[model samples]
Target: MTATMRAVVLREPGPVENLTIEELPVPEPPPGWVRIKVRAFGLNRSELHTRLGLAEGVTFPRVPGIECVGTVDADPSGELVPGQQVAAILGGMGRTFDGGYAEYTVVPRTQIIPFRSDLPWEVLGAVPETLQTAYGSLTVGLDLRAGQSLLIRGGTSALGVVTAVLAKQMGATVLATTRREDRTAALAEIGVDHPIVDTGTVAEQVRRIVPEGVDAALELVGTPTLPDTLAATRVHGTVCFAGMLSNQWIVRDFYPIGYIPTGVRLTGYSGTSGNLPPEVLQDYLDKLADGRIEVPAPTVYALDDIRRAHADMESDQVIGKIVILPISGQR
Candidate 1:
């Protein structure tokens, strides 16, 4: 008989209250898949957006975690040993398929990346989605180079901060912007060279540092802030749109010919298995293990308090990622 486990289930796209901790049947992985006994998982704004029906193509009665850290509980492929530690994400997790918002998540073998880390579950859980997105947007979308100047339009965001830290590691001069002046010091702590407060004229502040503007800009604030991000870039520089923190997706009044500067390139990136494959997840894990880059300790919550967790994330009060430990009583 199949066992049952604790899972945070979203019955519909409505409110945080829609997500409930329930006893669900343990999933048996299909052929070429494995069952992972989830230790921890990180939460994202995308998941929040999905719960509110903002994300398209998400079906109801869904599990909402996009990434997880756990052990291979059952691997029929014979490639992985039982109890082997691993991390899994991407491949339509929590979107098109059952995901990691549970005590056990059944994911495809192809999506699993063998990882061994001594770090606590919160830190490991925080690394997968954020690091994969940041790494892809920087290396794949922007192709960031050493000595170049980078402007992170939404620098105070979790992805923005991770990207800034990684860019600094790659020898880039990073300039960051935040709507709140209070976040300036925090941004600076993560190696942002210039933490400017944006007051409708972020380009002006950016131009103050580099007369022609920075070499590249990553637009994490979405279409509402895309113009300013583009304006903050040098003539030949690139601007990548990776997030929609402004909660705006389409440009209402778009004039591509006029809005786009001469010789400047605009690119949009979304992280997925095709763009951020499982092997890349392993690469990021290796980096974390070796201290090449670090993910901050996540603000943790019990799986039972998931409703409060969603409220906290939507409040925009928390700075870093929030983690969910399915085993609520354990530390």
Candidate 2:
């Protein structure tokens, strides 16, 4: 490999034009870190927010990718070896540190998980962020159980879709909301049962589906949909706030006594808890490898075409996960 590698760097927080490809010295692994030749990276909404100067404390001229799937080039800690495939999820990646929007990246060994060789590189990139977030939120935080019901707002998003799939796998009936009619059909193909169009009557529709209201609701659409989610959830049910795609308004009209009487639980989820505890992530990966669970990779882009990928992600045109291939290989 060359001593220098090409990387897409955001020279300053502006538009996609600010992102440029440049040659930089390849990074070496630190004590507990491994150097990776990145095969693919996954795009998240946080990247766009950081690029547009919306995310605070993000420095300029930074690489902005949250998740990556790559082969280890050097493992100084010996916990991983060269040529082994692995996946990485964002903790401080693309936020407080340099990220995976490059041909190579160095990640701490503790943040890396072994990738299943049976899955494609693009699929591997799609897994770390979305699956870990979904799994951790549903099972660990919300304490979701079998025979329960869940309502997921923004069902077509990468994390939302993964949450829906995992809910089904855990034997929970899932009701999801999508603004686009075309996406509803695709969501159903991935195990979502009730796909509601994001109309003003979303709560009513959810009520019709589960008359007692849903046992839980995953709030990905943020404030605009929070009211509907709150209205649709059953007494004593949990509402997991996983994403903030819509508005960030906090509900003020409702009295605390209302929820107290109803016994509803409101909570937030962040996947920064160290990649789903290894063992659970391994079990999920095993299921993915054996076809017991389907983790979809909806779009793939070459590393050079990263600007277009980010644009598509910001526009919400892509369905599941948008993958950036560092090596010009097919999915």
Candidate 3:
């Protein structure tokens, strides 16, 4: 391979205008890492936040991507061979370290999960972050069991859809909420039993649907709906705060004393805590292969169209994960 390859780099912390295509040196695999010829990388909302200087601890002139699907080019040990399809989930990629927004990337071997040949590249890129986060939060954080009820905030989000699908497959009743009423049917088709349009009365509607209240809630939207989530949760129910899409990471004005009266519990979920093990990832991949869970492909863009891809993601115009193809390829 050539010493240099094309990549989208964030020269400064700013808008999409700050991102530009450049020929950067190809990275080599470290001891426990593998170098991948990235076919596609998924664009995440956090990437945009990092670009806007909202994400804490990110550095300048970085490649911004967290999830990737590619083929192993070089493995220092015999653990993996060249041309094998793989995917990864880690914080440094696109933030503190060079990410998959390039022609090639270096990922830790432990972080890399192999994908079946039957799975498409775009779908592979979309799987790691969303699926791992959902599975970890639902299974590890909440201990969701069969026949239980689940409430997912931001039902239209990629993570939300994955959570709903996984929960339904595990025999749970899922109730989801979205800001757009038109998206309710789409969410319902994804196995959500109750899809609530986010009017001012979301809490009231959820209470009416499950008068006893939901068994658990997977909260992706932050403070804007925290109160509603609390109100909809059943006595002794649990709420997993997974994401802060509303940009409200800190909750200073709340007392759990009120929730104690209702016997409710609130816990934060983060996927990086080793909650999503290789076995669980393999299970999700197997489900994908067996046609059990389907993750929809978002709009595909070329490497040069990085700005347009970010714009589409930030505007919420896209239905699913946005994929960026570094090399020319079809859907």
Residue-level lDDT of model 1, residues 1-331, one tens digit each, is: 3489989889898877899888989998888999998999988888988888998888878988788989899888889998898888878789888899999999888777787767778777887888888889999889999999999988877888889988998899999888899999988888899999988569988998999989989998888778888888988899999988767779877788898988899998886645656666666667777877664557899898899988988876677688889976655
Mark the regions of model 3 whose C-alpha exceeds 4 Å error after superposition: 258-261
Per residue, candidate 2 scores C-alpha lDDT tens digits across 1-331 of 7999988888788888888888889988778878888888888877888888888778777877777888889987777778988877776677777789988988777778775467777777777788788988897668999999999888899989889989998999999888998788888888888888987548788888899789999988877777678888888898988887753636667677664326777888887637467677677778888888885655988988988998898888888889888876656
Q: Scored by CA lDDT, what does every candidate get?
A: 0.85, 0.82, 0.82
TM-score of each: 0.94, 0.93, 0.94
Model 1 misplaced regions, further than 4 Å: 274-295
Candidate 1 TM-score, true structure as reference: 0.94
The superposed Cα distance between candidate 1 and the true structure at residue 195, in angstroms, equals: 0.9
Model 2 worst lDDT window (10 residues): 254-263
Which of the two, 2 or 3, has more lDDT?
3
- lDDT at position 309, candidate 2: 90
Model 3 agreement with the true structure over 1-331: per-residue lDDT tens digits: 6999999999788778988999888997879888999988888878988888898878887987887888889999878879888887774778888888988999778778776556667767777788788988898778899999999988888888889989998899999988887898888888889999987447688889889889999888887778788788888999888877676667675677863337888887887615567677778878888888766655688988999988877778776678888986645
